[model samples]
Target: MTTTPAPTPDSTVAEWDHVVVGGGSAGALVAARLAARDSGTVLLLEAGPDQPVPRDRAHPLADAGRLVLAGFNWDYRANLRSSGRLEDLLKGGDGTGNPARALWERFPYQLGKVVGGGSAVNGAIALRGLPRDFAAWAEQGNPDWSWDKVLPFYKAIENDVDHPDHPRHGDGGPLPIRRTPRDRVHALDAAFWGECTRQGVTDLPDLNSGEEAGVGPIPGNTVEGERIDAATAFLSDARDLPHLHVRPGVRVTRVLFDPKDRSRAVGVETERDGRLDTVRARHVILAAGAVGTPVVLQRSGVGDAALLGALGIDPVVDLPGVGRDLVDHPSVVIWSRPADGVCTPGLPWRQVAARMSSGFDDDVDVQMGLLNNVESHTIPGFVDRLGWPLVVGMSVMLLRPRSRGRVFLDSADPLASPVIELGLGTDPEDVERLCHGVRRAWGFLRSPGLSARLTRTQFWSDRMVANDGVLRSGVRHIMNPGWHAAGSCRMGPDSDPYAVADQEGRVHGTENLRIADASLFPVIPSAPTNLTTLMLAEKLARSMKE
Candidate 1:
């Protein structure tokens, strides 16, 4: 059993039983689960405002609808490898010769700023990764992380409004998920899936039924048209708990480890309204996501020993893998010309996705999401950022890749955006794999079911789609991430050189500290990270209690 240290005579720092950093998607789960038990007090801290201001009082900066281009993002940049510096944006360069080059010399990699993290602003597509995806993690030395081991957590977390009667689905859960009725969903989305069936893919009416390796309508984490984000679903109950305390607009600058017991994490140093404060806790769980979690570790001297020495910070744990092995689903948008029909304004959360095994025969390694909006070709909605009035589009994505990127310090400042080297398309296999999906996407749009409804795209010239070689180059050039980022603080056996955490999500060489966010993923799941992230939080919470 673990012993609780006695308080010192002059101890004046605020203390809690557990201090959970970040209030994003994963953070909400941590806080909610901890506060539910009759355990000691739990404290949650968020970098953004905590209040759920009604839409009427929301400013443009704080607005949830416009999450991509708005100020509610930590816009990190992925620089070109040619210059290999963040300064490449000042003097722009053209395309890279190899598929191993940067998609954009300097493109904005946006991360959520609001309390619910990506869930508050994301497309709301709820998907679980393939079972094979989790099985791979078990092979990688995390046995408990196997798909079978964690399937119960996945089932328990969802309160499926559509498949509530399904044996695999749960009836009592905070996160409400619903399958869109056929009449409510857009025709274009329906046609795309219909064409997939014509192309030899069996129509998967319910993709989340543990057999999701086919084309289907995407389910969403929405309750009656409103988003049931992590904060909305989990934090509401947490807010009512007397033992739970939430502090918003508070940024953690550095983690506080015990000086005598260097491996023991005690609390964190935070800045709120420019006022510095020290809050101590018996345990600390960093759910600050893939990007934010590693930053905290590095800043607290748990990262690369040489880098910390250079930064004038004393090394605590000297773990070299603090911010390494970053992974994301690199995507490229395929736009068809304005269709014969006009896309109705303010449609419901429009999302449709498909999973296919590009390399393997059975297991899915590639997934594609089709969009019906102008701006996000990333996360589409009624909002339009592009000048093009009408278009049918799809986000072709390489779900799993051999490429690995990194998150390093831009400066010593805590508030600064970390230098995110989005190492996408770094491997030659990634390009070829994505190129094949792009060709498939083009072919699907050209099918009679899809092509009959659309005009040709104005964006693509003959040169861009001339042949396979040309399309491969185009895929490499236009590829971007699907905003599902993970694997910065990788989890594995401690023997792994790159592992930042053990199989139980505990940081190496430290006690009373664990990571429960996407950062702990050794590799990103083959689905939208929202559901997996919540399940991860539940796993960590239950494991710690046990």
Candidate 2:
């Protein structure tokens, strides 16, 4: 919350020390950090308006439905050309469905068009990947990006409330971290944990302790019962800072490069209020999430030469990895009615934490989550209160997925939407892994305690008991994406032709320009990416300063 002298507005020209395109999770964090460093003027341009989160929409139960239906958000559609193939395998038919076509025909990928971006609408799950996740970077030839080098950045961005003795978590960082309170613990959750122990899965105490290979209660990026979106965590307080200028309703059309030398990016050309404006900056950072950053680069003529040429775009930088290697976590639901007591409303965050701390049995496959409907008439409510005579039901997600996809330009126009193909479970192993997750969820629901509370629902009743063909179909019916999209613009060593950026997040062969966002991750982390993107922004800001 630092204050400095404001820059004089010009009727003729727009100028800044740094121009950050896209005000999503990554953009907000980078803007706040750069401005906090007292670096010269920084301009943050968002393509959408600043829409406030309504109380009803903010509720965890309500948020899920809203995310799938809301408009002000950038609801980018993902093409599942691969998923259709999987369907053909099961149904013995032709696989030709196009989700991207269907969605773009109506809407777009679900990117948050508002100020906070996806963080404003995400499920507040705060998780970090295993230490080996980072070590893998070194193996790929990025020496400066090993686990040892990036651990400090992770610690600097978090404020953990649960394990005080833990060394990796910070206590006073801008983002707050804590488990759900005890009062909110639902009965279904307790039963689920007990079953997981019986099934030999270990209850992990922390997923963010540089070890994400196990199961645990999902930690959230929430502060005082509200979602701590990136904008609120990084930019809200910093809005008054004179060094930072956040423009909510501006769309960047392209990155402006020096015509004489394409190696250096000068600034950006944007459109606002039906007028075009160019903002000059010594440095330019693109933090426009996965799909956006790549599209921006392509529009700026920085992608595959052939692809660019085909689109009538002259190539500036021929980086083939600009829109490849997309990854995301997919989930499946197993619903059942408890035999007895009313299924509680809200998650039992505290009870789950206590179980984790007590050295509970080690069942390490699926993380069991307890979700309840308190008041809102969302999916949980219909299932728990109205759909049938039931107490509660639960869902478990496969945290780590092996699936990979891509983002590509559908047309050369910057205003035209890009193609995002989420090749979910295309890999046989990924399908098997998610099926295992579904089995684990069923085990927890069918346990002695939980099973005694209610009757099993009929939609998948006969299919649930079967071990072969029907099970796969049942899993496919329920499993969808967690909406954590990333890795389109991967980072790697100079030798990697597919790498969009180097270890410092600078786009390959480009000077005075960088990409500091989820787009920079060579591989998507095991957890929700909001906090990790913020941590990356903090690290990039420090790196730029030095």
Best by TM-score: 1
RMSD of each: 5.1, 5.8
| Model 1 ranges with Cα > 4 A deviation | 1-13, 53-69, 80-105, 357-363, 373-387, 461-463
Which ten contiguous residues of candidate 2 have the minimum total lDDT? 353-362
Distance from true position, residue 100, model 1, in Å? 14
Q: How accurate is candidate 1 locally (lDDT)?
A: 0.74
- Model 1 lDDT tens row, 392-445: 677677777788877766456766667677677888888888877776677777
- Can you give the TM-score per candidate against the true fold? 0.89, 0.85
> Alpha carbon lDDT of residue 495, candidate 2?
85
Which pairs of residues have clashing backbones in candidate 1? Answer: none
Model 2, total clashes? 23
- Across residues 422-468, which tens digit of lDDT does each residue of candidate 2 receive? 77767776666656666555655556777776576545564563575
